[model samples]
Target: MALVTGGSVAGPGAVEAARWWMRMMRDPLATYGALGRRYGDTVRVPFGVGRALYVLSRPEHAEHVLVANQDNYVKAFTYRPLRAVIGEGLLTSEGDTWRRHRRVVGPVFAQRHVVGFAPQIVETAVAAVERWPDGVMLDAAGELRRLTLDVVGRALFGSELAGEAGRTGRSLETLQRGAVIGTFLPGATAKRGLYQRVPGLGGAIGQLDGLVQRVIRGSSGGELLNLLREGGEFSDAELRDEVLTLLLAGHETTAASLAWTFVLLSRYPAARERLEGEVDEVLGGRDPRADDVDRLPWTRAVLSEAMRIYPPAWTIERDAVDGDDIAGVRVPAGSTIAVPPYLLHRNTDIWPNPEGFQPERFMGEQQRHRYAYLPFGGGRRICVGAGFAMLEAILVLATVSRTHRLDLAPGVPVRGRAEITLRPAGPVPMRVSRR
Candidate 1:
């Protein structure tokens, strides 16, 4: 493969790249946007004497790295911290391990099978929403987190996790923040044992371990859990890892997307009104069912649009296993490439008024590239729970919209925190009122 040659490639020099890296560590989402604007789609920032981290924003680049020539890439080293925290679960494991885990877990999330969980999802959401006091200010983010945790726990693990949501949320906050810092640490430091000794991370990991243990000990013969146990494929440690991975990834991402949807609805009342009107027309004051998901087009579109704006899995990164030319830029082996959905979704060329919240973009037949709006990523490594998540979000949104309206608390500032996921920086305070 040819070296990154001539003016065709653009980026900062070693010194400048070092500075950019520092800034990225501080505020990655903003820094990535700034880099894209300053350097165009493909920007190569040198890491050391030979290695480079390429920030590729184009959909074609995403398609190439994540799909077409995916064989030449693996999850980037940036995922090491997360792997250390979650262990060799589906999210982090590679090669035969990943294939084996996927084989065991994939069937459960099939659209046909996933629909069976709809009743549990709807029931959980309705029960949670009923508990919300009318005309009171509450943290929408926290509430959604609890609701999602409970749904995943009951639907998948046969455990009730609503009570654990508060501590789990705090632990996740600490773990995600530390994971970013841990990325720059030495390789060996990614070990679970070493992390257990760190100040905040130690406690966070302990809390997660306790939660996973509770799930394992308290499981009530959930189908997925029974399948894993009866198969005899997973060892004790592997089971713990996979359980923790599912518990965190499955719940956190969905919660974040729902919270963002609520935030966007509050900010754009017109969109909220249309969404409410759609819910009222379709469900008629009844809790949403599996079939109701397809009937609520606007609700689904609103969730899709929210995810496009604040993709939970904000970045999809890979490390090259061999030299290759991506589009026209030459990439050497061992190069780190980030194809962030946050950037791709907001690419002005593909999306008209990219920053605006417009559910209509997702309502009808769309003509954008397949890789342009990857809220759940692409190719084989795409989120395994994608179908399940969409189902849960649509149902939960419809259920909530049927009986309640949550308005953002006046004068509160909401911001995004870019960690393992892109979620609200703090509590998303919103006032709830009966519809």
Candidate 2:
């Protein structure tokens, strides 16, 4: 990394260049793609304030930076803004604080406890399916959001948050969009102020804050929220941080994951038929339970294949704390490295017919590197909720597959957008028919 200083003395173009870099960062895929086409994968957008962004999008680069010499990288400055919003949760905190938070929240997201939540997830999905009207076009993305939100609410806090999810969903959209942009700007009192002034962002934060407080005060289950409340390891502010982080992370990502899964299913009727048959044969119109996840391998594989193509948590970033060598490129200290699952999963070198829908690729044994799939990420800092989210998604998928078949409306284009997560920009219109 070149030391960038005294450029402002040259001209106003330096500052304008910085703003241009920021704009490009706001939507990285398009920016990165264009840059990669122009200057290959390692393109640095010089902000001219000793804070340039080096966007690298490849598997070897990702493996080297995110996992193999992981100690040299810290969460990028971009995470600082998300940290202000969520506090000392697993996603944002650094060093000991992150380690401690992970230790406390980690065990609950382990496979056993995560699988334990499958029953609640299935119940929620079954309940949603029962409400569907035959041949009625539905916003599948929104429906999946509601389902995931409900499951996260019930399974995490033992509360009925479905009623709040609609408002919460809209609010969350504003916050996510704002938070990413906000991360770069130097703000005063990021926790207590700033966002409070933005209309949708502020109002959404308030609503989310209130909910976090309520959950922290009293939760109905032995979920992570209850454990956090009972442990009293954090103060009110700290507790609010973790709760909000979990809510923001746990709900939307899972929702997008399922939404994409259903869309792919709609496009591939043969796959859908196979999936529906499996659900019928195993679950038999009953809701899925923890014990049945193993039997529903195709259901799990369908969701896996969807994520490989359209990962909700599409990108990951880390700022190098020290200079390191990744494959052959020399990364100097303070360089921001990107490991986007979107590109890695689509890498034609690793995945044959990468753009096609092929759940059969996941069948038999996976011979690829564990890091090769990487939807939930990898190593010690990998998503703590990976197991929990998978269990919930599979369970919900099974329950829905067993009870109803949703057909896509004729020729309705599937639109996608990349915010903090990659989501369908518009509704996924599909008609519901009871099984």
Report, for every candidate in turn, its global Cα lDDT versus the true structure: 0.92, 0.77
Q: What is the lDDT of candidate 2?
A: 0.77
Stretches of model 2 off by over 4 angstroms after superposition: 1-26, 37-41, 187-192
How far off is residue 119 in model 2, in Å?
1.7
Tell me the tens digit of each residue's lDDT in model 2 across 287-373.
678888889888888999999999898878888888777766665678777777887787666898887999988888888866778
Q: Estimate each model's TM-score.
A: 0.98, 0.91
Question: Which candidate ranks first by lDDT, i.e. highest?
Answer: 1
Q: If candidate 2 were superposed on the true structure by all CA atoms, what would the RMSD be?
A: 4.2
